[model samples]
Target: MTTRFYRRTASVLLAAALAFNCAASFAYAYSAPNESDLDNHQTYRNHDGETVHSPAHSRSGEAPDGATARCRDGTWSFSRHRSGTCSRHGGVAAWR
Candidate 1:
């Protein structure tokens, strides 16, 4: 009975650890990219001459030019306004 208890405790601990790891991975995967991950030269200015968020991407590849945001669907946004940016593309994953 003692051996069975120990085995069950170990199994439970291992399962808990796996669950936590999976949750952490999922959260990190969907979070916004860091500023350092972006290409600073990709930024553009609006009509008011104010600098806007530029297209940001990981090392996977380059985002399109004039892109102002990265969509959750893995697309780039060129919207001049932020109100509805990426509304149709599963919402904005990260504002560029």
Candidate 2:
């Protein structure tokens, strides 16, 4: 009887741990920054398909208006919108 009780307790604990881990993973997967969260800098693939980091746009050396600036691959062609291609290094862009 004692051995059966111990086995049951251990099984319950294991199940609880598994549930917690699954919940944690799901939370992380769906996590994303909100609009209110300031993005002073961003990085993205450029037209040349190279990974590039863009400098933060700041007012008086400080981020203003919460306008998050991000580094993006490809030159900004004023004539066309959404015509830029990814950077040469693939689509990985990161901010400092």
Candidate 3:
């Protein structure tokens, strides 16, 4: 009986170890690229003349430029060219 129990225990332990190793390998195989892949990226210039570097996996598109105009109520959304940007921000910017 003792020998049979030992055999069963050893077999169960071996099976568990194999299953864990297989699961780990499968997870690693399907994983996405790591941080080193992000080092290879592209840089773009926004309207504010600031350079913006993005990783490979980042969303490929343009984000808003720098400060357009801030309102007295602290409201400044995206507005290009700035023709009528100050009006939307409640008249000329005070630069506060």
Candidate 4:
């Protein structure tokens, strides 16, 4: 009877620990930054100690809005697509 009671007590303690851990994680979520505060992008610093460009959310066949891209032909263009090809130039494109 003693062993059975000890086993039940241990099971209750384990369940309480697991519940507390999950609740703590959920509470911490309240402090996470909003999605609008973070956007998809990439940044690079030029030799002149300046940020050359800060690219933002962009997609293929859309206006580049001043961003630049490199084509497979070793030329530069602006286009962001899954194909990595400039929709305007018909060549594989990559962010410069």
Candidate 5:
């Protein structure tokens, strides 16, 4: 009976710890920033000392507001940083 009770207690504690860990992970999980949460039209210097604008508008096709550069793949970039800005889209073609 004592052995059975200890096993049950251990199982319960393990289950409780797993549940707490899951809840804590969910609490600290990464969430994408909202447009309203961003500072729109704000200018800042990048690591290269070049003036850059924060991503303001979430648009497609044409160049949106606060676009800093254009990619070689014909995509506009609103990236705040110069490095890795248009790395995925075949690098930056022109700086706007």
Candidate 6:
């Protein structure tokens, strides 16, 4: 009787562990972005002179010529024909 009870308890615990691991793996996979979503998207400068693009948090593309500074967040920003330091979250400022 004792051996049977132990075996049942071990099996239950193992099943619970497997279930938890599967759930966690599924959650992680859902949270991560797939690479296929980023194809064919081109980064470009917005009307505000800041670089804006898709596929959230992607760091790609080069600034146009005469750009004095560059900034990046969800998108990239480039300053053309202007001299200053680019701010990631804000506007340009004098370089220190």
Top model number, TM-score: 1
lDDT of 6 by residue, 34-92 (tens): 33443334444644455433223233344322233334333322233232334443544
Local accuracy of candidate 3 as per-residue lDDT tens digits, 1-96: 699999999999999999998765521111232333342344444455544332232132222133333444444322333334445335544331
* Predicted structure 4, TM vs. truth: 0.30
TM-score (all chains, Cα) for each model: 0.37, 0.30, 0.30, 0.30, 0.37, 0.31
Residue 9 lDDT in candidate 3: 99
Once superposed on the true structure, which residue ranges of model 6 sit more than 4 Å away at CA?
29-96
Model 5 worst lDDT run, 10 consecutive residues = 26-35
> Model 3 off-target regions past 4 Å?
29-96
Counting only residues 3 or more apart in sequence or on different chains, how many pairs clash (N, Cα, C under 3 Å) in candidate 1? 2
lDDT of 5 by residue, 1-96 (tens): 699999999999999999998765522212233444344545555565665554433444456545677778665566655567777678888987
Model 4 agreement with the true structure over 34-77: per-residue lDDT tens digits = 22422444444443343433333333434244445545544333
In candidate 2, position 42 carries an lDDT of: 55
Off by over 4 Å in 2: 29-96
lDDT of each: 0.62, 0.37, 0.42, 0.44, 0.60, 0.40
Clashing pairs in 3: none
Error of 6 at 56 (Å): 8.4
Off by over 4 Å in 1: 1-60
lDDT of 1 by residue, 1-96 (tens): 699999999999999999998765521112333455455435556554655554444454666545567889776666666666677678898875
Better lDDT candidate (5, 6): 5
Better lDDT candidate (4, 5): 5
RMSD per candidate (Å) reads 11.0, 12.3, 18.9, 16.1, 14.1, 16.4
